[model samples]
Target: MSTYDFAVIGAGISGASVAFELQAEARVVLIEAESQPGYHSTGRSAALYTPNFGPPIVRRVNAVGRAFFEAPPDGFAEAPLLSPRGALTLFKSGNEGELAAFLTNGTERDPIHPIPVAEALRLAPLIRPEMVAAAAFEPGVTDMDVAAIHQGFLRGFRRRGGDIRRAQPVTALRRDGATWRVTAGGEEISVATVVNAAGAWGDAVARLAGARPVGLVPKRRTALVIDGPADLDLHGMPLVEFAGDAPYLKPDGGRVMASLADETPVEPQDIQPDDLDVATLVEWLETHTKTSVRKAPRTWAGLRSFVADANPVVGFDPELTGFFWLIGQGGYGIMMAPTLARIAAALATGGNVPADAAAAGVNAADLSPTRFRF
Candidate 1:
């Protein structure tokens, strides 16, 4: 039986970040079920960073994560992970109340601004003139270099003496005194600590360790790629979003990618696109934009796992002595990865959690897995 100081299950951004952070201090092994790393939702993210995208807590995480994208560590990446890209939120007529609420909620960091109809179209040429009533723009949005960032983490982790094992899914786990005996790839691997960063399969991992589920739910989200005009110049284009997040569009190479923002509850598995979802997204785009998308070039789907309260589950499990919960990141995992990894690493290594995080009400008990028992 091989022994490791820490065994991180899941090689997505969350697990990768955690393994990398713990490499210098512990002998860590990163296990991924897929043939390749990030074969699931991590590689299929929207690939953009917007500070004002989600709720207040998510926004705070994004704010702290922006630092890593702005300046990555040496030898991790050659170029910056963030590129300038704006975002425009569109509101239909007679929905002045939602617009006011959005503006009020987004003006905290001065990143969101109310823009007139003409200005909205000027920023994103795809917006229809008559359909647009009013809009808000945030020039601070940036296109996230997800591939580079993932590679950076992998490179750093491996260089720091961390091992990454792909296609080694943990099938059974049990606590043996102070260590865990994990069975994966027909072998028994023992570890003093286990980090449950298994994304959609978080609950299953916990169950393997005889721990209770944390109510983590995996929701399906679909995306479709439509062909754009042959001579389309997508430069200076902002991510155009409909009010209440009904549907949205973003530039993808020479094509345009659109989504219905559907959140269908699903099990943890390899997800595929729904044809009806693609058709609905195209129809929605036709109603909001002038671009006539008859059919899409490609369509795909992935799961964005979340808990009952929609907050990320970090820190250790109160019930399981050596088990850590780093799941339920939802759609904001990529944007908040840096901060989340740092906090998880700190808690795992018995280091002091940041004062800012504590000030933001990041109590250990609050993120414990037992919170769901009550």
Candidate 2:
């Protein structure tokens, strides 16, 4: 039996990224159940890279991850991975409280300034002239190249002589003292550590190891690609987020990408867009914009898993010495991948979390899986 140093289950952005980072230092194996890697949430991402978004810890990760996204290592990306696309947050006439919090929370990390109706319309041509009472714009947002980032991590992992095993679902786990026996794809393997980056199926994997659940809930979010205005120039348009997340749209080349911004709780499985959601989104879009999407080119959905507090859990279990967690990233996984992976690897190796992450005020106890222990 080849006793490897680390075994990462699941090949989503979280798993692949952690494996990619740790494989260089230890004998590692990256395992995935799908026929290929990134078939789950990674492939189904909205592919946006707004750093000044998400929780404070997430924002810190996004800020640090920008370097890797902007300039990947050699032979990792075919082209530039980021294209500048700013963001606009629109508030209704009566939602002053929500708008104030948004601006206050946002401007701390990046300059988020209130814009008038004319300014908002100029930033996002799709915003209806009558729907906006107040708005804020963050000009530093960009559309992330998720595919390129995934490939870059894989390339780096492979370059360091890491082994990737796809179509391998881990069926069982047995602990022998400090070592772990992992069975996947009819092959038994042994490893010193098991990193659980299973995304929505995280709790189940922990249960298999007799570890307690961490209160992860998977929610479905749907998105659609529709016909954009042929004559309109939307190259530098900011991502317009409407009040209460009712519906939002961003320009994608000649097409427009619209989302209902719905977070319907669901089981972990192949996700599909609901017809009612589609109808609601279309109605909202028509109500908020002059350009109507008569039909959609594509519509799809993905699960975004979150803990009760909506914070990512990325550390080792206090009870289970060798089981590390990298789950509950919600929709912020892609934007926060670089920093999360690096931090996760450091923690797994028994090193301290970065000073920046600590300064971001992420409490170590808040991320521990032992909180659920009876």
Candidate 3:
């Protein structure tokens, strides 16, 4: 018989963040299926805050979000959220043209400049010298402490008198007159509004609520960690990736963390790392780096959900009055969470986009779920 102003489904990064923003002025409850928050993508994220990444709208969201990462709210987190770590994009001979387009790709916010091949190797000494042709380095990229940021939002949300129900999987969503009855863990709660931030399972959750699917395709991405050269200072190395769509390698502790960069379409569920993906990644790592796969490496996979347009869908549903969509963040969820949370909180409460978000050139219409109807 408990009632709340809002019930946010999925206590992952997306849900936890937006719930924190919404609980500021309204009664809010965060419901999670897992016993712990961020059990999926958020926990597994090799997160980096690079403004140059993602599409234009996501970049704008990062524009507004950078300040938050730079200096979060007082008492939000104990330590700084960011660590200095650069990114290097390698061009293997024929791919120099791609680097050319990227440099002049508009907006000086990228923090990347064309670097000599020698300089690129100095930054990431593992790439095969025979294969590298040209390179670009992004000095503005930084490693993000995903856990701290997620925990900060959750802590702040709870500090503001918000409730969080862990291990509660939302089984049913029914509209009772003007109220939304959300059933989770065999208990039902009525709320004036429901915000769906279920990530890869977004469309499924919408179907459960009797809303139309927004064409969300959950894609699985696999990453692995392997041994690095003993003489190399892997700790100080920059994140390295090839030009165009290719596997990426970075330093994790004393080992090299490499990603297959594969986006295979998949169903929404607890995904496991595909053996073929791991094998393919090992081959790529051996070919790209100066390392060999002497033994099996550690591998994991997570889902990145995207809509047809490859941009995030965030707004009130056109047909369902109180059902809001804050899903489809794709791979840019963590970096874009801060501003997206602000925008979602504002839009769900019958308010316009916040001033800071507007100044960042975020067109709310561009992210509206209604765009999928056409």
Candidate 4:
């Protein structure tokens, strides 16, 4: 059997980033089930980087990752990873309480401030003036070039002698004394450590390794793309989101991408957009904004896996030696990739948490898989 220092399952963004970070210091092999990497969640991301998006722990990771996205390492990418694209969260007249709570919770860490209705309309001309009572703006939000970043990691990993095996779905993982014997696509691989970056299939991978499941629930989120007017210029239009679990619209290449932000729980597998979700998104857009949507040219769905507490599961498994958990990123995987990859590399190589992570107030224990044990 071919042997390596580490075997990372799933060549999605999480696995790619971790493998890229570890390749220089250790012999790393990235295994993917699909014919191509990022066939699922990573490739279907909305590709927005808003610091105030997820839970507090997620926000902390995003904070640390921002520096890297702002200025990637030397020779990491051919073009910039992030470009400024502001975000506006609007509240209807009756939903003022929710708006207040959002501002109260987000203003401290995020660059979120109250914006007048006129200014909010100026930022996004598609919004209906009478529908909005109050709005908050985050000027630091940016449009992330996810493809470029993922490619950068893959290129760097290959350059550093990392091996990537596509079309190999891991079926079994057996412990052989101090190492792991992994069976995938009719091939066996021996590795000193195993990193479960399998995204939606994280629980299954852990089970294969004789490790306990962390209760990862994969939720389906759907998005639809609609055509825009030929003369309409979408430049400088901020991503517009309504208050109180409403639909959001983001500019996409002179078109608009709309979503209801649904988090419907589903089994781990390839997912498709529901007809009702598309209808709901269209209804919301018609009711809250001036944008018209007759039909969607394309609609798709992706799974955002999350544990019970909704924080990412990182660090080594408590009961399994040399088996690491790098799952439960939810919808923030791309935005938090750099910091999470750094943490995974540090833990796998017997090193401390990276100084940048600590400086950004990221406590490894908070993201550890051990928290779910008790």
- Which candidate ranks first by lDDT, i.e. highest? 3
Model 2 lowest lDDT segment of ten: 365-374
| Cα RMSDs, all models | 1.6, 2.0, 1.1, 1.5
List the lowest-lDDT window of 10 residues for candidate 1: 360-369
> Which pairs of residues collide in model 4?
none
> How do the candidates rank by lDDT, highest first?
3, 4, 1, 2
User: Residue-wise lDDT of candidate 4 within 31-54, one digit each (tens)?
Assistant: 999998979999998999988878
In order of TM-score, best first, we have 3, 4, 1, 2
In model 1, pairs of residues that clash are none
Please tell me which predicted candidate would have the highest TM-score against the true structure: 3
The worst-scoring run of ten residues by lDDT in candidate 4 lies at 102-111
Query: How high a TM-score does candidate 4 get?
Result: 0.96
Q: Higher lDDT: candidate 1 or 2?
A: 1
- Positional deviation of 334 in candidate 3, in angstroms? 0.4
Clashes of 1: 0
lDDT of 1 by residue, 231-342 (tens): 5576668898877657778988767888778899999999998888888887887777767876545888988999987878887787888899899989899988887888
Compose the digit string of candidate 3's lDDT tens values, residues 21-109: 99999999999999988888787777888788788888889888989999999999999998888898888878888887877643676
- Candidate 2, 271-343: lDDT as tens digits: 8899889878878878887677765558888899999877788888878768888999998998888778888
| Between candidates 2 and 4, the lDDT winner | 4
RMSD (Cα, Å) of model 3: 1.1
